[model samples]
Target: MPSAYVARVVLREPVVGARTWAGFATMCTGMFIAILDIQIVATSLPTIQSALGIPPDQMSWVQTAYLTPEVLLIPLTGLLTRLITMRWLFVASVSVFTVASCGCAASGSFATLIAWRVLQGASGGTLIPAVFSAVFLLFPDERQGIATTIAGVLAVLAPTTGPVVGGWITETLSWHWLFLINVVPGTLSALGGVWLLTRDQPSGLLRELDLAALSLLAVSLACLEVGLKEAPELGWVTPITLSCLGTSMLTAVLFVRRTLAARHPVVQLTMLADRRFAVGSALSFACGVGLFGSVYLIPVFLGFVRGHSPLEIGKIMLVTGLTQLATAPLAVALERRLDATVLALLGFGLFATGSALSATQSVATDYDGMFWPQIVRGLSIMLCLLAPTRLALGHLPPEQIPDASGLFNLMRNLGGAIGLALVDTVIYGRVSGHATDLAARLASGDGEAARAVGIPQALFAAHAGEPADPATRAFVAPLIERAALAAAIDEAWILIATLTLVVILALPLVRRRAEPTLEKTP
Candidate 1:
């Protein structure tokens, strides 16, 4: 009995009190800025493209460069934390991120900018899992709710407010400031992390690092990220997309097999065998689909369909961010009192409804039309993040938390990647068909089609009563494309909502947390 109890005991005790909280907050801030950089740069890509004289075709590489390394490095953070203590790992990451930000600001060309972005992303990738792992390592189980709330707020909030922040920065200060803004925050976080964090001795795990597995992981994630990025534009079945995805799959299989057979795997895939963690991971993925999909959707609609500038779009999108801020406390409080599964169900249900509500939007829908759906989604955001987070990482022993956090967060990111691709696929695939159908209807004197094409009734009568002149068709072409885009975006909304709802079906399979039989010894 004593031997069994010894085996179950936490190897490291949770750090307590004010200093640890400050240390945890420092890590969270680092994470926030890292995540914020992604959105800030994303929203202002056009400005950057124009300033750098990058061709439109090549502009997306700026983001793709950052995202690929980010995705690849995220799952490796556990191994990194083991090799270097969390404090040093965070400080090093922040330093690299800060310096890379400077490089980004000084870049004279697209190639230079993308090179710096890759470094920025590689370092930034560790910040998220580091903070999450800190939650479990730094706080006792009872206090984890509040800790997670803090991290969760920033985690969700960065992306929520990123567009607005990016838009404002580009409009007022220029795109350079987007990367420059991280300097002070990143530096301070690093310094504070060094001062406040309790140091843990390294496990001398460096010698055991498996280079082959590392190489495989790098190839798999890089290919997968590039594949997903290009799949939307080039079509999923194209040679480029297929080759990248196929390589990712084949390498991923080898990596998994190698990991499972190894005594000390880089990432702990065996965690999936735990029913609660597995279900929680699935829920996390669904939440990602909604979170990232909506962020991408709203901006595209405002910018393309409504012809809103980035600044104006950001202002309109503030509805979601402000609502999230207002409801955050309520969410944190409920997380403490509510059943994790029940809270997750409620959150997902609201998210699905919110997504579905947005699908009802038309070409003419604007801020007033989008307000309530954003509100509902904002209200549910914290709930979605907090509940599944607790379900996934809450019950795990301290030693396992780092690897578990990496895997759990990886699922969310993967969901986001796949979801965005699907959204793009829907919009790009169906827009032309919608335009053709609308054109035929307009030719048949359909009033609704005329309205969608924005043709005046008198003008529509002229066009429909006779073969339209080239001048008239030319005038109507842009309007037809706009209406078709709006229709396509609506279908994409329904796709994400359905995905979120479908995740709920697996909730029943997760077992409830078993009651504790032994108190954790200090």
Candidate 2:
């Protein structure tokens, strides 16, 4: 393991008399709140759409609204640390997030809800980097592993359990409860943060904000996320889609160039020069893409395609969440014995395998088909994430931990955007082709058995509130049902293929390093 020289310096200064346990608790609490808010809203989208009367096409914007600001603001974390005292920045962000949660709960219109969600994302984006900085500052080298274990467990659990929490609220209460639940926790965290967190005065040089870099980063990231999100609906070749993609790419290039040239760049590109950090960051990006993409795909498969209720879908995810929770501690223990890179690669492989299994699912598949795959995925995530985070930040100077964390997280977000775009595009194309073929066959009056498996003529006549002519109903309804089933199956296959590719990519990247071990730490 690395020496505690960096850790000692940070603790002796910013943390003052704070104990390790107290610091850990505070950071964990803060991170839990931030992550919880993001996940809670995800499962409640169905209820939110019904309650708000939002159009089907516009519903995704609720998620995009939050994601846009969150990712866009992530790269600025390093700059924020220099400008404001950590304590004040954390408290202010919690306040913003808390207030926004309340606003979401009280919102009567979709527009108002989206605006509050954007504010919430912007504020919540600062929490993770700040917490990582605080944790690194409080723990010594030997205990850093334990600190990370605690934090990482929570990070994994927040998203895993989100569906369960959201489902319970939406089924028993209302969608508004999703946002309302956040207010209490956020408020409590804000109060706790102010009282417990030690204040660090800002460095005079960094206190002056760089408005130019900030604006450029915000616009560039927003454009990139927006373009990716819109590509599926608008078709990538369409003029409007091409314009958004082109503009996003241009702005991103300018942002990178400006950062490299500026006297005080918002993000330090020099960090990427470190081979370990570079590899670790790449892994993080792939993990993010696979993780978020599956999160989106799984719920859609279970609920919309399979006709499972929100509560039922949530119940299924509970098994996966519990499995991950069980595996996290084991991962921390194994990291002590194994090479971090090997462990991460193994984890990624398991995750990819799980995703492949999930992709093979069909309308007839049951919980048995999903259970083991989810457990494997949970285990893989634990192994993959715990070691890579340590590997990524372990070698950095204590003062630079915040910057490294922020940059790592930013890449993960970007990876998620790219993954979502890629998966959706593939699924869309595959579904369209399958739907067209199925329609054509049904129209040709071929394969009576296949046509009967799709839509029954009597059911279609009942839905129409009149006895449909049997031939007409058979022709139209089977085509519609077959199209829907084909689309769902196509999505599953795409998710499987994407995850398999991720595993293949990760295998070559997992290289062993002859680093010192934890017991040898000074």
Candidate 3:
């Protein structure tokens, strides 16, 4: 068995005499609120777009607005930890997010809402990793396994519950309710953060902030995130796209150089050299891709292709979320007896398998077919997330825990951005390719025509929603049928390829160490 080691050292000094569940609960509540806000806006997007008259092309920015600040701020977390007391930061972040939520609700234009979301994300970005560090530091070494388990469960659950909450608010009330709903939790968390969290000021020259690096870091990440988000809509080779990309790359290079030269760097570049940390961050990146890609894809499939309501998607996701919650303890328990590396590998395998299975979905597939994949995927994530985290920080000195956690979380967030972009690009390309190919076949005077392929002319006729004489119907019917089938196949193949890549990248990171049995704590 690996020796029990202090995973975190509280530099600020612990105010509470001993760790209690209440303390953990309070810490997690802050994290829960932060993550909940991240996802709650997702299901409400269509409603927001319609009510605000947002262009379809600009609709994605609502999400990007939040994600951009969040990703950009993640690396800065370690620096923030040194610069400010955790208690003050937590309270400030919660307050910012709450106010931003209100701003989002009250916004009259797309630009205003996007601005609020950026503020919300920037504040939220600091809160999450800080909370994780707090939890690790609050608990003793012996209880870390349990603490990690609890933390993992909350992380998974917040996002899982988001769709359901967002859907309910969007369907039953105005989309504004999605933002307004956060007010209560946000207020409570802010108050709780101030009351429950102890404060201590860090000493020495490290307390001084690096203004140059901070500015460069923010500009670099903002440009990069905006570039990635806009690249799909703006032609990649366009002057604007090239400008954004160039600016992002240049700023990023400067940020890195500035950090290395700074007396107290905003982000510690040295900690990344730790093999466990490096490997874990890489795995987290891949996991982020699979996680966020599915989060985006599943609802799109259900609502657009299957014609399900937001409420129905929420209901299905609720089931999947609950299953993940239920499996958290089991996964944690299993981790004790297994090497974290091995567990992560197994988890990723299950996730890839689940994605592969989901790729086989069709218009005729029902809830039953969908439920199993979600269940497997949920269990897989529980195993995958915690193990990589454990493996990454396991060998690090306690003082470095916060730095490692921040970087690990940052990579995952960046991975989500990259994954979503990649998947969307692939699906769009494939769909267009398939559509063009299928259109050609339909136009060809071949024996295996649309009629020969067993597609009903009426189905395509209904899709056009136009009354057609037999001549018009015959000409248009085959094209519509071919297009639908091609789109479906294109989507499936893209997901298949995505999952395959995830498995391929993840395989090497699995640990070759012998499994150790976890002992129960009293």
Find the candidate with the highest TM-score and give its number: 1
lDDT (tens digit, per residue) of candidate 2 on 407-434: 8878777887888888777766576566
Compared with the true structure, all predictions reach lDDT values of 0.90, 0.73, 0.72
**Better-scoring candidate (lDDT), 1 or 3:** 1
Predicted model with the maximum lDDT: 1
- Write model 1 residue lDDT over 1-522, tens digit each, in one string: 355555544443564889998899899999999999998899999899999999999988999899889888888888888899888999999989999999999999998999999999999998998998998888877788888888988988898788889989988897899999999999999899999998898864787888899899999999998998899889999999999999999999999999999888989999999988999999999988999999999999999999998778888888888888899889988998888899999999999999999998777899999999999998998899998899999888877888898899999999999999999999989999999999999878898888776778786776566877898789989999999999999999999999999999988987877665765566
Candidate 2 — which pairs collide?
1-516, 1-517
What order do candidates take by TM-score, descending?
1, 2, 3
Candidate 3 local distance difference test against the native: 0.72
Which segments of model 2 are wrong by more than 4 Å? 1-19, 204-208, 439-522
Clash list (residue pairs), candidate 3: none
Question: In angstroms, what RMSD does candidate 1 have relative to the true structure?
Answer: 2.1
- By lDDT rank, best first, the candidates go 1, 2, 3
- Runs of candidate 1 exceeding 4 Å displacement: 1-15, 456-463, 518-522
Worst 10 residues of 3 by lDDT: 5-14
Encode model 3's per-residue lDDT on 286-366: one tens digit a residue: 777777777777777677656687778878777667888888778868877777777877888788878777777654455
Q: Over the full model, what C-alpha lDDT does candidate 1 score relative to the true structure? A: 0.90
